[model samples]
Target: MIDIQFRREDSNIMSVEMSGHAEAGPYGYDIVCAAVSALSIGTVNSLSEIAEIPVEVVSANDSGGYLKFTLPTDLTQKQMETGQILMKSLYLSLKSTEEEYNEYLRINSLDGK
Candidate 1:
């Protein structure tokens, strides 16, 4: 199963970490994995290319799968807004995926509590 964690600081999404394969279908044919990957990679690209925000990020595919993004400590107001929008889109996409594919994916509430 894929495990996803989203972190929030002061009511703002501060980071997201996802790891593992969905194992929902054959490796190359897993829609769950595809959807998750698109949301994560797309949002990360948007944050860097469109939002133009510097982010602490890491990704790996060697063992299972992994991706993480941490918001910069200091951001201009516009940068913050754009990054938030991108991350929020990710959040919503993952939520929708989880709703339809709960057995193949999971969203762990690893948000700073």
Candidate 2:
């Protein structure tokens, strides 16, 4: 399972963290990549109309299977609200995709069930 967390540090900054477990191999990498890609897209879309914010991946540990990102900038109330929704949607999508992919790999690994 993957846990994604988003927190508003202040009116001008937000942070996101993602961690999860999956089959140790290519499957794990695929899941992480998918989640990161979706996150990047969601962030860009959410902040496009707002000011150009600085996004930094604070840390990412493959061994521990976790990633943290920080985004900083002043944004309007409307933008903040929209960003919250977008972030939630992105996280859910990533979690769902990871589960689905892991299930597929599990089934494929079976000999002949």
Candidate 3:
């Protein structure tokens, strides 16, 4: 399971954390890596292009399977809305990837019989 939490320090700054287990198969780590890469890139692009706000990937850990983001501190209301959209997109992407990986494992197990 993948969990994402978003915390707003003020109207302009926010923090996001993503944590989950990677145990589906050999490709589990790959899936997680891809998700993290996509999220990091997507968040930076979204904030810069859509929100015009600066964002950074504060820390990332593959062994422990966690990622964190620090949002800009001068965001406007529109930028905040954009941040919410980006966060939701990242959360959904992680969740759907996990579900897909789990389903792949199930199918692989069945085929191995």
Candidate number achieving the greatest lDDT relative to the actual structure: 1
The residue-by-residue lDDT of candidate 1 on 1-113, one tens digit each, is 99999999887898999988899889789999999988888898899999998888888857648999998969999999988888888998899999999998999984654
Candidate 3 achieves a global lDDT of 0.59
TM-score of each: 0.93, 0.47, 0.56
**Candidate 3 residue spans exceeding 4 A from truth:** 1-4, 8-13, 19-29, 60-66, 102-113
Residue pairs that clash (backbone atoms under 3 angstroms), model 1: none
- Candidate 3 structure quality by residue, lDDT tens digits, 1-113: 44555565533226666666444446645665565557657777787788777777755454665666777666687888887787666656655664666532111111111
Clashes in predicted model 2: 0
Most accurate candidate by TM-score: 1
- The RMSD of every model to the true structure, in order and in angstroms, is 1.4, 9.8, 9.5
- How would you encode candidate 2's per-residue C-alpha lDDT over 58-89 as one tens digit per residue? 44554755666665556566656766665556
List the pairs of residues colliding in candidate 3.
none
lDDT of candidates 1 onward, in order: 0.88, 0.52, 0.59
